[model samples]
Target: MSERLSSRSLPVEWAPKVDPRELSIGIVHLGLGAFHRAHQAVFTEHAAAITGESRWGISGVSQRSASVREQLAPQDGLYSVLTRGLDSPSVQVIGSMREVLTAPEDPAAVVARIADPAVTLVTLTVTEKGYRAVAGGGLDLADPEIQADLAGRPPRTVVGQLAAGLVRRAETGAGPLTILSCDNLVANGPFLRRLMEDYAAALVSVPEARVEAVSSRQRLAEQLESTRFPAGMVDRIVPATTDADREEAARLLGVRDEALVVAEPFIQWVIEDDFAGARPAWERAGAVLTDDVAPWEQAKLRMLNATHSMLAYLGGLRGYETIAEAVRDAELAELAGELMTRDVVPTLTPPDGLDLTAYGASVLERFANPALKHRTAQVAMDGSVKLPVRLLGTVRDRLEAGAEPRVASLAVAGWMVYVAAGRDVNGRELPLDDPQAARLREAAASAGPGPAGLVDAMLSIESVFDKELAADKLFRSLLIEGVGSLQSH
Candidate 1:
């Protein structure tokens, strides 16, 4: 056993700016994962340090498992964020988290934390699937867990847990709160608010006999109305932490840290300045609080996220394991630039005074940072959920403008080929980590071994492509050609 990370053992040079003992839990964060630790918690700590506020400490809840709690509790929620730059690595001890709880072990404890009047803000990074969104942007009420949640059973999903907690808060008069979404989804704030509201309504609209014995429908509605859901955009390439990363942290601090997180030395957070109550002075900590986040959101989604997906599929097919290796390839690098300049840029109305060109270049540079080993497989996960927002929008806009979405078409084709083969070009097994993986594989297998048939079958997925695009002759031809090109390579 090694020494644990705590205030007593913290090195002098890496000490937290604000004394951890003075901080109080004022924020409740869901999905206690690497991204949250590297992004939001870091910002919150800075916000408190800048404002001399000791009330912004966070109580983190792991939605699915107890692993995070087990790692951080013994250390008193102290973790090191290793920023991997091109030249050298820098480490910072994050002290924003004051408590850790796992939903599976004690959901009531998580709910109780949320109901605490001192915790005025709630933030989430539960990803796309956690929202349980359907095609038309509504809750997937048909999902088994969602159905059980609506019927007032103990909540199992993120949205379900949120609904249950907020309802409890309402009944207990815990006051108004703000909910901020830090996910990659387009218009994430409003999207999450709708999902939560819909879930609450479903709970109340249940048959009278099935309604839970807690609060009335009207009370829940009133409490929800008081809650605020602010949309925000967060950008950082924080990879899943490996055992090697933990060992490195232990070497640096002379103490073992199981909750270590590794990230590239770049971070950007743009949030809509819409909050119901007090918030951290994150602006002082390098966050941009704007009245309108749409332009920035669109820019990041189209340029950065879409290009990332392209690299994951196309680069993975070319036998690259990591993003750094993939982006260094001349052909793939040029293709990424083309995708942004030609197809993606046209679809974006970037925020005023923003340079889309420079942003695109910087994104490529970040992808090529050799210090960060971001796996292509990690970025490629949940393709079925990510494609419509990241790439398809560009394709749709370019088609409407009478211009060919050549690169976007190729990206779609790359995804199709990847899903069909289920293995990289190097003969490595590629895990299809997607909700629609089974359906996609069956479709590909049924279409026979030819690229043309596979292209037709993939394009026909109604959940992924709009009916018009699926049936478009030009789109179909371009996709077929793209698929054939991949097969030849």
Candidate 2:
């Protein structure tokens, strides 16, 4: 065969792949990253292929990065995805996207696309921290970004931006649109809609004092009628793209394609039964559409995400770089598996007819996938933002049921040590990434010799975990032991 064609110049064989001119951006995805490309885009591509509907093509939008735009814009948004595994590797040109819009390049244009009637679904993979969760996915109306978007000037943040675009579309009678949140948070859709509507109302409301006067409980219960935030459960381990990914893409395509996304061979999308506007036939392409995504969400959050966090903080502190490496440590891996099967899984009410044991086994296998070098730092970042749902939620749930939460406490303890800001077992510096990282370090520094002091800081931060849990004796004691083990080790 001849040398590979330049990614900048499409080959005749690939021109029929994804005709950008023939596609109107029907889906607007925020946070254009590897997960989105490997998971959502690939699903949409398959859906369109089955139905022969070019309108399912996507218009990717990125708020901060221009690199994806530069690379994808040249190739007409047709990039290749390589799914590498221990035994096999598969390559395919994913054609779900029609173009990309980097917000910095033209904010107005990006907003206009969201407002477009042709765009019926707005998907996101902005991660757990990016959602800015407050009290069980409750709306954080005090957020300045929400305030700004409500004022109708412009949005500085993701929630604000989505609200702004939705308001514009709503005003234009663009009909109903589905806001698909693909983050790891439990009840991801409702979490997103809460913020979107809360922000939009702040824009039209009278005063901040009056808005606050309306209690969040009443506000949330009232807004359930008109909104369509479809909760989803997503799985797949696509690590942050390293320099090697870019080099490999260049070599494979015979030209530099900056936007190439690399991932493992696994993907999944389980969504709740709600969609208002036009939507792609994602079910035709293997996506699960059901009346409830709660069980799946709960299962994934408590098992996959919670276990990952445990490994992340502990492994990062122990000087393990990647999750695979961390799990390879006999003790840590065994501890992780034990925490899941014993503590986390037992607390959860598994979906009807689902085998919890099988699920837990699968989670362990995925974590041990050697090909996906999911870094501990990447998972460990933003503890304050992630802990509420990823860790504390499960702990709080089990506690509410009056069940023993020893393993959960250990996870919390791991978080405590991880946040202390120091070297791990190997003496390599552990660079903390929480929003309150500095404050946490300062507190741990001034804390007493026991883990009680460390646990106190984490629970006391009303911004991070539930305040009621702070006063519990068992919670504090377990965390203390957890801290003592690592600190002493």
Candidate 3:
């Protein structure tokens, strides 16, 4: 029988701290996936260790299922993060998470924990769809989950759950708290705040609802005023853990750990310095706390994420499965460099001291890390939700400046072909894992298998393109040309 990873078996030399018995849950994190475990939880563990702030333990809630709880609870929320490098792997046992709760099983418990006065900071990594936010930074009440939430039903979405939690907090006289959004969207904090405000306002205005369960308009307004939503930029390449990774962890730790997370050696978190209450000493763990995170946010989104999407689409079309495999192609590497320098750079104004050129080069180097096995299909999963912030902003800026965004247009065209065919050039059935996949597929099918018609149909998508971009003759022509090149390839 294999040994199990727990407090009893964890080696002392691995720098483990805050035994599970002594940890006090002070932060509540939603979406307890691999990325959160590898990135935020690791940082929190280090912060607690450095400052002896054992109270900052995380109560991780898995939004959809009980899988994470099953993996972690038996281990007492202890897991090893394998930092895979080209030469060797470094392993650290993370102990910042004290409890795991599955939302579908016990959402009320999750809300109560969030409402608890001790829980001053709530962080989320639920992807952009979790926000259910519209273009102008307000809750999309039209969403079925949001509509159900508005009807005073049991909360379903993250926005509904957070709003419900805040209402309970106000009712119980819990003080202010901070909500940190660790997703990749630009200005994520303010954006989430707007959605929360909109959700709360809807609750206050609904007459048939339980008046006492929901906060009054004025009370909700005060809560909104007191609460802080700080935007954050988090970067770490954490591939989905494989069975081989689990076996490796078992060999290294002398125990079989179901909750093992694997990631690259590089990790960075740039968070806005605004907070409503006590926070972890994250800066001690190499996180950058800044008054403004906009520049960094923009840099990562356009420079890293945009190029990542570009490569995912184009690379998959060329039968490359992993990011490293794609970037290894000399032609694709040169295309990435050109896209970053010529297209993405002009659209960005880097912060006072940040060198855009060097940063872009480093980003490419990180992508080329062969150890991580970052799958192109994984990055390509949510194109519809990602494109606006990642690639479309640069497209708009370039067009406004009278410069044709050739590389950016190619990325968009690549996506258009990708969604249309639903299969890579290698005949592998691609996973169309986007929220808007159905509509996108329908639009492509309606265009009838030709690149020109499909490009036209995709460019007309209002959600991805604004009216000006959809109507610009020059932009549409470049997109057509780009799609033609992909077809010819």
Where does candidate 3 stray beyond 4 Å? 204-207, 210-216
Give the per-residue lDDT digits (tens) of candidate 2, residues 1-489. 223324446455444355556667788998888889989988888887778787887888887879887777766667777676776555667767777888766777777888788888889988776765476666666666556544544565677666556656655767566788998887788778777665545543635445532443234333334447899998888888777766665555555555667787768889887987578888998898899899988888888888998999888888899999999999988888888877788677887756888888877778888877889988888777777778787777777878767777787788878877567888787778776787777777777656667777666777776668888887777788788888888
lDDT of each: 0.87, 0.75, 0.87
lDDT of 1 by residue, 58-117 (tens): 999898888998888887788999888897687889888899988878877887888898
Rate residue 142 of model 2 by lDDT: 68
TM per candidate: 0.96, 0.90, 0.97
TM-score of 1: 0.96
In angstroms, give how far residue 19 of model 2 lies from its true place.
3.9
Candidate 1 local distance difference test against the native: 0.87
